[model samples]
Target: MKKGVFLLCLALYAFSVTLTIFVQAAGIADEKLRLLSSFGSLISFFAVLAMLFLIFRLKDNKESKVKSCGQKQRKNPDEKNPSKEKYLEFAARNGLSRRESEIGYLVLGGLSNIQLAETLFISLATVKKHLTHIYEKTETSGRKEFAEKVKAF
Candidate 1:
């Protein structure tokens, strides 16, 4: 949508420039008016280009952040300290119900309580209850700490 608007603006600018040139050739537009029109056109074009460059840079930064987040998720670990899978396995090994495991995974995935409730077809109250039990069992403060602890697993 933004790109479309930009293109439309560029096209309108081109049309305006063409019209200005035609008017000047026909002796209708004065020299001062023509010079002002050219200056305005240059400023508008540079401004648009700068804006587009900034947008591209922002998009690239967002992509890099997403890639780094994925890399963190896929990091390999030695057999010594507990890994994320191990922590999850421990949760399962401790006889946590499958629903609780699902909740744990969602929490680890950075979903908020409301997001988890919507995704799991559960109520917000139920999500809170499950999260409380999860915190107690995992011995973590909240979701952010829970995710950090899981990262060590």
Candidate 2:
């Protein structure tokens, strides 16, 4: 969409430039009319250039935001969580399956059951079932105990 708009603006600018040159070469007798026409064409040309610049800037900002968001989501599990290694070790020690360990990580990151379901793209009941299995495997009573045990590691 932005590219189309930019192209259209470019075409309009080119047309305006050609028209202005043609008008200048036509040798009109009225100086005032010629000056007014030149000024109008100049203004339209600058407007088209401004629109193109703004569109490009907007596209750049949108692309940067999308890239940053993707990077942030992918990096958060390890980079932002200081206890990731400890959690992994804890998971390994407890013989947690991959899914349970993922749930554990999100739980440690302070996600609620609903958030866990949303983040993991699972149903709420599935999240609860995973938590139950995690609790049984880790031999912890609940989230608090699990978190305490992992942190103590």
Each model's TM-score?
0.42, 0.48
lDDT of 1 by residue, 1-153 (tens): 656666665776676667666766777657777776677677667756755775787678657654543332322333133455786686876456778877787565556676666566578999999888888877888877776766565
Clashing pairs in 2: none
Full-model lDDT for every candidate = 0.67, 0.76
**Candidate 1: lDDT of 83?**
53
In model 2, where do residues sit more than 4 Å from their true spots?
A: 1-82
lDDT of 2 by residue, 1-153 (tens): 767777777776777777677668787668786876687598677868778697889878767654443332332455344367778888999999998998888787767787676556588999999999999998999987887788778
Shift in Å, residue 34, candidate 1? 81
The list of candidate 1 runs beyond 4 A from truth reads: 1-87, 93-95
